[model samples]
Target chain A: MDLNIAVLAGDGIGPEVTQQAIKTLNAIGEVYNHNFTFKDAVVGAAAIDQTGDPLPEKTLKVCLETDAVLFGAIGDPKYDNDPSAKVRPEQGLLKLRKSLGLFTNIRPIKAYPTLIDKSPLKEDRINGTDLTIYRELTGGIYFGEKKLNEEGTVASDLCEYSDFEIERIAHLAFKAARARKKKLTLVDKANVLETSRLWRKVVTKIGESYPDITLDFLFVDNAAMQMILNPNQFDVILTENMFGDIISDEGSVIGGSIGLLASASVGEDHSMFEPIHGSFPQAKGKDIANPIASILSAAMLLEHFKLYEEAKAIHNAVEKALELKVVTTDLDPSSKYTTTKVGDFIADYIANSE
Target chain B: MDLNIAVLAGDGIGPEVTQQAIKTLNAIGEVYNHNFTFKDAVVGAAAIDQTGDPLPEKTLKVCLETDAVLFGAIGDPKYDNDPSAKVRPEQGLLKLRKSLGLFTNIRPIKAYPTLIDKSPLKEDRINGTDLTIYRELTGGIYFGEKKLNEEGTVASDLCEYSDFEIERIAHLAFKAARARKKKLTLVDKANVLETSRLWRKVVTKIGESYPDITLDFLFVDNAAMQMILNPNQFDVILTENMFGDIISDEGSVIGGSIGLLASASVGEDHSMFEPIHGSFPQAKGKDIANPIASILSAAMLLEHFKLYEEAKAIHNAVEKALELKVVTTDLDPSSKYTTTKVGDFIADYIANSE
Candidate 1:
C-alpha cells in the first residue's frame, strides 16, 4: 500500500531527529515492501522565520494533503523567557490544532522492563506498566477566550466546553479501550471545574452506548497521585488538554526516559505523530539526543494505517536494540554510541531481523 | 499569651495520633511557660454518627471561641467505598473551611536530611528542600454550584472565581513570599482554565505591590512534573484548591514520606492545623501510624502565633528525634517504638532540650 507522510521538522533538534525517523521508516519500507512518500513543511519558530507566520497557509496545505504528519519539536528558548511577547511559537501549535480540527491526542505510556531501574520510582512500582492517554485536543482551556486586562496586570482565560466536543473524544477513548483492556478512566476535575463536569457528563452518556466498557471518574489530583502509585491499573486514560499536558509528562517519567515515548494527535479527519520529548535545542546537531522517540513515532504511523506487521517489525527492532544496549546517552548516556550510531544500530537490527 | 486550643480527634486512629500531638503541645506549655487550655470537639464521620452534623454547631462555637483548632484525621473506609453517600466526612472538612473563612491553606514542606534517603528521589534533590504552599481554600470549584440533570445521570460542578477571591489569596501569597526567599511560583492552568488565568493575572498585579518578591507562572501540568523533577527550585507556591490538592501530594514524595509533612489552614479570623496525611483508617489505633506530621503541625501553629523560638524548638526536636531513629513504623516500621512511644520521645526531647 502507498502512504503520503508530511514531515514538519519545526526547529532546533527537530530536523535532526526527524531525519533519523525517515531513515528508520525507509528501513521499514524496504523490509515490508511498503510505498511511502514524504512532504516537508515549516512551522513554529521556523515558519515564523520563513514567512512571519507560525502556521502559514502553505504549511497547513501540506499538512492537509498528507495521510499523517510526523512533527518534530517546536519552540525556542528565545520566545520562552520573554513574558511580553505576543506571537509565540506555542500559539502556532494551538492554532494548528484548531485549524486542523485535531480533537484527540493519544499518548501511550509503557515502562520498559530494561529501564525500570532507571525510574525515580521503586523498580516494583514502575514495572509492568502500560497505558494510553486520550486527551481532548481541540477544546478545553487551551482555546478558551483569554484576556489580559488593559493594565497587563490581570489575565483571565475562559474554559468552556460543549457536549459536542466531549462526545468525539469519548468515542476515541472508548474505542482505544476496546482494543486494549476494555477499561477507561475519565480523568477530570468533575468535582470542581464546570468544563470538567460537562466532560464527565458527556463521557458517561457515551459510555452507556458502549455497555461492555468499564468506566470510572477520577479527580485530576487523585489521578496524578494514582499515576505515580499505580500506573498499571490504568488502560486507556482520557482527559482534557491541560490535565493531559501534565499527566503525559508525568507518564513520560514512567518510561524511565522521555526519549522513548511517542504520541499521536488525531481528529475526525486528520492525524499527526510525534515524539513526546521537547526540543533539546542544546542537543541540536550534536547527534547525541536520542532519536528513538521519533523512530517509534514512525512505527505508530504504520499502526495507524493498520499495517500491523510493519509496526511490529519496527517495535521489535527497537526492543532488540534496547536489550542489546545500543542506546543513546539519555538511556545509558555512558554507552559508546552517539545518536546517529544508535539509529544506525536500530535500523540495522530491523534490516537484519527481516 | 493565653490560648484555648480546640482538639477534634475525628476517626480511626484520630484519637491515637491526636493524643501524641497533645502530648507534644503540653510539653511546649510546660517548657515555654505559656498558659493553654484544650477543648475537645466532635467532627468527621464520628460527629455524623453522634449529631448527624459533621461539623456540629457546638464544634463551630468551640472553634470560634478558641484561638486555634487542632484537627486529627477524618474519613472512614465505610464512607470511602460508598460514593453514593450524600454526606461524606471530607465534606465536613471542606465545609469547615468555608464556614471558618479559611481562605489560605498553608502546607510547609521541608526535607529532613536524616530521612532524605527514604525518598525515591536522590538525596541532592530532596536535601534542603523547603517549600510553603498557599492553597486558595474555600473558593474555586470546591465551593462552586453543583447540579445534576433531572435524570440524575449528568452531574455538574461549576468552578467560578471572581477577582475578589483571587485577590485575597494572592495577597496572602505575596505576603508569604515577601517574608521568605522572595520567590513565588503561581501554579495554574492559565493556558486553559479561566480561574487559573484570573489567578495568574491577579497574582502578577499583586507582585507589583511588593517589588522584592519574584513571581512567575507554571502550567499545573508542568508544575506537577517540576515538583518531582526538582522541588527545591520553589520557595512559596500559590495555587487554587484543585491544583493544590494534587501538587501537595506530589510534593510529599520529595520528603521520602508524607508522614513527615505538616499543614495549617489560616483564615482572616480563625486558624486550623493538621497533618497533610489523611485518616489511614486501616492504621487506626494500631500504635503504628506516624505522628511526626501531627507534631510538625503543632510546630506550624506555634510559628503562626509569632512564637518563632517555641516553633523552632519543636521543629528542631523533631529533626533530632528522627535522626535518633525514634520514629514510627511508617518511617521505619522496624524501628524500636510504637506511635505513642515516638511521640513521647519527641515531647521528651522538647522538654529536655537546653
Candidate 2:
C-alpha cells in the first residue's frame, strides 16, 4: 500500500510530538512493507507567524491532496490571553474541519493498569473502563447561527440538527458498537430540547436495522454523573457536538492524565488523527512533555486505514512503555525520561515486535 | 419570630425524609422560643393520585401563604418509563419554579470526613472539597423557544441570555462568594457561544465591583474535568441553567451519596429548600432511605430567614448524629437505624443541645 500523510504540527510542543508519531509511522511502514510519504504543513500559531494566516491555503491544499492528515496540538499563550485578538489559532482548526468536511470525532478512553492510581477516581470504579465516544463534530450549537442584539443586551445561539446529520453519526456509532460491545448509549436532553427529541426519533428508527445491538438513552445531566459513578457501563457514547465536547473531556480524566488520550476526526471523504491534550506552551522545546497521546494517535491513523494488526502493535508498545515506567515527566514526575527517549522506547518496541 | 412552613412531601421517600426535617424544625422552634405553624400540601405523584394534579392549586396557595417551602423529592418509576406521559411529576416542579420566580439555585457540596470513602474519587482529591454552585434556574436553553420544521426533518433550540438574567444571578453568586471564600469561577463556553461570551462580559464587568473577590473563568468542558480532578479548588461556581444541571449533578457524587446533598432555590419574592436527591421509588416504604439531606434542607431554610444560631444548632446536631454512627441504612447498611429512628435522633439532639 502507498500513502501520502500530511503532518500539521501546529505549535508549542506539537512539532516535537508529531516528530515521534512520524518516526513510529515510518517504523510501521518498514515492518509492514508499505510505502509512506510525509509532507510538512504549517498551521495554528506557527502558520500565523510564518504566513500571516493560522491555516495557510498551501497547508489546506496539502491536507486535501493527502490520503490522511496527522495533526498535532494548536494554541499559544499570546492568542489565549488576548480576548480581543482579531484572528486566533483555534479558528484555523475549526475552519480546516469545515473545509475538510470532517464531521465525526472519535475518542477512545482506556484505563491503563499501571496508571490507575494516578486517577482521582478510586481504582475499583475506573478499573476495566474502556469506551469510545462518537461525537458529531461539525453541527449543533457550536456552528449554529449566533446573534447578538444591536444594543448588546441579549445574545443567543441556535442549536439545530437535521435528520441527515443524526443519521450519518448514528450509523457510524452503531457500527462501532456492533464491532465492539453490541451496545450504544445515546446521551441527549430529549425531555427539554426539540433537537434531542428528534435525535431520539431518528436514532431509534436507525437502531431498528441493527437489532443485535442494544440501544439506550440517558439525559446529559444523568450521563455526566454516571460517567463518574460507573464508567464501565458505557460501550459507545453518542451525542451531539456540544454534549460530546463536554462528556469526552470529562472522560479524559478517568484515566488520570489527558496526556494519554488520542482522537480521530473522520468524514466520508477525509480523516485526521490527533492527540486530545492541548499544546503545553510552557513545555515547548523542553523535551519533558508526554508524547504517548501523539503516538497513540498514530495508532488511530493506522486503524483508520484498516491496518488492524499494525495498530494493535502500536497499542501494545504503548502499554509496555507505560508498564515499564518508560514515560515522560507528566506520567512519572520523579523520573528523568525525556520526551524523545519515551517516544524512542515505544518506536523501538514497535520495530522489534513480531 | 413566627414562621409559616409549608411541607410538600411529594412521593416515595419524599414523605419519609421530609417528616424527619419537620421533626427537627419543630425541635428548633421549641428550643428557640419561636412560634411555628406547619401546613401540609400535596405535590408530585402523590398529588396526582389524590387531586389529579402533580402540584394542586391548594398546594401552590399553601406555598405562597408560607414564608418558605420545605420540599421533598419528586418522581415515580411509572412516569419515568412512560415517555408519553403528559402529566408528569417533574412538570409540577418546573411550573412551581416558574410560578414562584425561583431563578437562582444554590447547591452546597461538602465532603464529610466519615463519608469521603463513599466517593468514586480518591480521598485526597475529594478532601476539603466544599463549594457552592449558584445556577440560573429559569433561563437559558431549557426554557428557550424550541422549534421543529414542518417536515419533521429539522429541529432547533435557542439558547438565549440577556443582561438582566445574567446580572441577577451574578449578584446572588458574588454576594454568596463574599460571605464565604471570596472566590468566584464563571463556567461557560465563551469562545463559541454568543450567550457565553455575553456571560463573560457581564460577569467580568460585575466582578469589577467586588474587588475583594477573586474572579476567574473556565469553559464548561474544562469545568467538568476540573470538577473531578480538583474539586477542592472551586469556591463558588456560577453557570447558566443547562450547564448547572450537568455540573451540580456531577458534584453530587463527590460526597459519595446523593442522599447527603441539600439545595435551596431562591427568587426575589420566595425561596424553597429541598434535598438534591430524587424520589427513590424502590426505597419508598423500606424505611432505609437516607434523611440527612432533608434535615440539612431544613437547616438551610433556617439560614434563609437569618436565623444563623438556630441553623448552627441543627447542623451541629446532625454532625453529632453522623459522628456517633446514628445514621440511616443508606449511610451504614450494616447499622439497624430506620428512617424515623435517624430523624428521632436528630430531633432529640436539637431538643437537648441547649
Candidate 3:
C-alpha cells in the first residue's frame, strides 16, 4: 500500500506534536511494508507570518492532491488578542474545511481504563463509556445569516437547516452506527425548533433504510444531562453543528485531559484528521505538550482509509504507553518523559508489535 | 408581615412535591409569626384537563394577585406522546413567564457536603462547588421568528437579542455578583454570533458601574468545559436563553441529581419559583419523588422576599434532612422515607427551628 499524506503543521506546538505523529506514521508504514510520502505546508499563524495569509492556495492545493491530511493545532496569542485583525488562524482552518468540502465532524469520546481516575466523573459513571458524535459542520446556526438593526439594539443569527444538509450527515451518522454500535441517539430540540423538527423527520425517514439500527430522541437539555449522568448509555450521538460543538467539548472532559481526544472531519471525497486540543502557545517548543492526541489523530486517518490493522497497531501502542506511564506531564505530572519520548515510545511499540 | 401566595401544583409528582413545599412554608409562617395566605390555582396538565386551558384566566388572576407563585413540575405523558396537541403544559409556563414579565431565570448549582460523593465528578472537583446562572428566559432564539421554505427543504430560527434584554439581565447578574463572590462570568460566542457580540458589548458597558465586582468572558463551548473542570471558579454565570437552558442543565449534574436543583424566574414586578426537574410521570403516585427541590424552591421564594432568617430555617432543615438520610428514593435508593415523609420531616424541622 502507498499513501500521499499532506502535513499542515499549523502553529505553536503543532509542529512539535505533528512531527511525532509523522514519526509514528512512518514507523507504522515501515512495519506494514507501506510506502508513505509526507509533504509539508504552512498553515495558521505561521502561514500568516510567512505568506500574509493563514491558508495559502499552494497549501490547500497540496492538501487536495494528497490522500489524507494530518492537521496540527492552529491559532496564536497574537491574533487572539487583536479583535480587529482582518486575518486569523482559525479562519484558515474554517475556510480549508469549506474549500475541501468537509462537512461532517467525527469525534470519538472513549474513557480509557488506564486513565479513568483522571476524569472528574466518578469511575463507575465514566468507565466503559465509549461514544462518537457525528456533527454536521457546514450547516445550522453557525453559518446562517446574521443581522443587526440600524439602531444596533437588536442582533440576530439565523439557525437554518435544509433536508439536503440533514440527509447527508444523517446517512453518515447512521452508517457509522451500523459499523460500531447498533444504536443511534439524535439529540435536538424538536418540540421547539422547526429545523430540529425537520431533522427528526428526515432522520426518521432515512433511518428506515438502516433496519438493523435502533433510533432514539432526546431533547438537547436532557441530552446534555444524559451525557454526564450516563455517558456509557450512548453509542453514537448525532446532532446539528452548534449542539455538536458544545456536546463534543463537554465529552472531551470525560477523558479528564483534552490531550487524549482526536477528531476527523470528512466529506464525500476528502477527509482531514486533527487533535481536538488547540495550540498551547505557552507550551510551544518546551517539549512538554502531549503528542498522544496528534498520534491518535493519525490512527483515525488510518481508520478513515479502512486500514484497520494498522490503526489498531497505533491504538494498541497508545494503550501500552498509558499502562506503562510513558506519558507527558498532562497525564502524569511526575513522569520524566518529554513529548518526543512518548511519541518515540509509541512508534517503537508499533514497530515492535507482531 | 403578611403575604399572599399562588400555588400551582402542575402535574405528576408536581402535586405531591408542592404539598410538601406548602407544608414547609406554612410551618415557616407559624415559626416566624407571619400571616401567610395560600391560594390554590390550576395550571399545566391539571388545568388543561379540567378547564381545557393550560393556564386558565382564573389561575392568572390568582398569580397576579399574589406576592409570588410557588410552582411544581409540568408536562404529562399524554401531552408528551401527542406532538400535535394544541395546548401543552409547558405553554402555560411560557405564557405565565411572559404575562408575569418573569424575564430573569436564576438557577443556583451548589453541591451539598453530604451529597458531594453522589456527583459524577470526584469529590475534590465537585466539593464546595456553588454557582448561579442568570439566564434571560423570554428572549433569544427560543422565542424568535421561525420559518420554513415552501418545499419544506429549509428551516430557520432567528436568535435575536437587544441591548435592553441584555441590560435587564446584566444588572441582576452584576447585583447578585456584588452580593455573592463579586465575580461575574458572561458566557457567549462573541466571535461567531452577532447577538453574542451585542451581549458582550452591553454587559461590558454595564459592568463599569460595578467596580467592586470582576467581569470576565468565556465562549459557550469553553464555558461548558470549565463548568465541569472548575465549577468553584464561577460565582455568577450570565448567558442567553438557549445557552442558559443547556449550560444550567449541564451544571445540574455537577451536584449529583436533578431532584436537588431549584430555580427562580423573576422580573420587575413579579417572580415565580419552581424546581428545575420536570414532571416524572413514571414516578407519579409512587411515593418515591424527591421533594427537596420544591422545598428548596420555597426557601428561594422566602429569600426573594428578604426573609433571610426564615429562608435559612428552611435551608437548614432541608440540609439536616439530607445529612440524616431522610430523603426520597432518588437520593437514596434504599431509603425508608417516602416523599410525604421527607416533606413531613422538613416541615417538622422548620417548626422546631429557632
Q: Please provide, for model 1 over A1-354, each residue's C-alpha lDDT reduced to its tens digit, 9 standing for 90 to 100.
A: 898999998878888888888888888888889888999999988887788888899989988888889999898877767898677787777777777788988888888878876776666667788899998887655665555555544444445667777788899889888878999999887656666777877888899988889999888877887877678889999998778887887777755788888998888778889998888888888888888899989888888888888888888888887898988887885798887887888788888886
What local lDDT does model 3 show for residue B325?
96
DockQ of 2: 0.94
lDDT of 1 at A309: 87
- Residue B55 in candidate 2 has what lDDT? 87
Best by TM-score: 2
Which 10 successive residues of model 2 chain A have the least lDDT summed?
A78-87
User: iRMSD per model?
Assistant: 4.1, 0.5, 0.8
Where does model 3 exceed 4 Å of error?
Answer: none
Q: Where does the lowest 10-residue lDDT sum fall in candidate 3 chain A?
A: A249-258
- When summed lDDT is taken over every stretch of 10 residues in candidate 3 chain B, the lowest stretch is B345-354
DockQ-derived CAPRI band for the predicted complex in model 2: high
Kindly report, for each predicted structure in the order presented, the TM-score of its chain A compared with the true chain A: 0.93, 0.98, 0.98
Q: In model 1, what are the clashing residue pairs, if there are any?
A: A141-B192, A155-B201, A157-B194, A329-A333, B119-B256, B329-B333
A262-345: candidate 2 lDDT, tens digit per residue = 999999989999999898999899998899999999999988888989999999999999999999887887988988998898
Quality of candidate 3's docking, in CAPRI categories?
high
Candidate 2 lDDT by residue in tens digits, B128-169: 999999999999998889999999999999999999999999
Q: Please, what are the lDDT tens digits per residue for candidate 3 over residues B220-274?
A: 9888888888899999999999999999999998898789889999999999999
